[model samples]
Target: MSDPSMTTTGTMTSTRSLSYIALFAAVIAVFGLIPKIDLPFGVPITLQSLGIMLVGCLLGPKRAFYTIGLFLVAVALGLPLLSGGRGGIGVFVAPSAGFLLGWWVGAVVCGLCMRQFMRRMPDAKGKSLLIAAFLSSVIGGILAMYLFGILGLMLAAHLTLVQASLAVLAFIPGDLVKCVICAVLVQSVVRGMPAWRLDRD
Candidate 1:
């Protein structure tokens, strides 16, 4: 395959990139259809974050950011693309808005880390992929999401940091489950279907 970094000058090049962005956006949205569990704390656990991390690891930062941004736009436009099939402007304005916003940042962070890992481990071993997936999710998805989520929880719900922290703590078990799922899923894909290994590019 040709190098993605090798830019060709023309309108067609931009169009192709846009097409990829759209395809990835659709990927995230379609995956949103999977089962979602809403916690009592108003934050729901969904597979969309898993999709976000996977897209980032495969598509790189710029593409990953656009993919997630597009997903958010669709949700804002009343599409049932969010957890619990919830959507529309109301979702964006809700207390969970911070997490919605954080999705894009998380994608970028995950993509950057994935790219760096690929660079560092050009001929990565199986165990390395698992570690990369875990670290990428933690640093990229969880932490980034937590920061924005806590801030939004404080602002939208009028809760203090301590209170919000306790509330958000409710999702720890779920988040860890997601992390485990991410690692296992990524490893399986990369090992079984080498074509899914985006690092070769």
Candidate 2:
């Protein structure tokens, strides 16, 4: 004896979740529209990483992962949705591929961190949430992404591990700045929507 109203509510919730996932995928693509800085070695720098941070911080682990996956699917379909308007199967073999793929993992990691932190501090205020978001961004958005990025540079550019690692140093400051910006935005969201659920359940 299933309740029709409950079934309808479940269907609505599922639809809403799908909408959020697609919207965030679009958000990432929009971030890619920003101009990228081309570098002689390694890959170019872009603001797309910030989008990953934001999605993770907002959407929880599972949904954030799905959002990033959706974005990748679009890229694989030959959409000009990457920084510098590059796309197609060729981009998969490019030096930035690992970093691009790493974003999916990064989003999951960041969302997991956010969920854990928020759960531990159920009464966490905006400032506390900011700290949590910043730490998570560093761990997932920067560290995890860089690990894959370095490997990508080595494989695609034929750079030694040391050389690839060194080349990435130039982008650290910018990434840190992005972390701060993401944290601030996330903090604002928490303050504005205290009833927001990490899982959106």
Task: Assess each prediction's global lDDT (C-alpha) against the native.
Answer: 0.80, 0.86
TM-score of each: 0.82, 0.91
Error of 2 at 19 (Å): 1.1
Regions of candidate 2 where Cα sits further than 4 Å from its true position: 36-45, 199-201
Residue range 137-179, candidate 1, lDDT tens digits: 7877788878888888999999999988888887766776677
Residue 100 in model 1: lDDT: 84
Tens digits of lDDT, candidate 2, 1-201: 999999999999889889989998998899899887655655566889999998888888889989998898888899999887988889889887889878988998889988888888877776887898998899889998899999999999999999999988889877888899999988887778887775332
Per-residue lDDT value at 153 in model 2? 91
How does model 2 fare in lDDT? 0.86
RMSD to native, candidate 1: 4.4
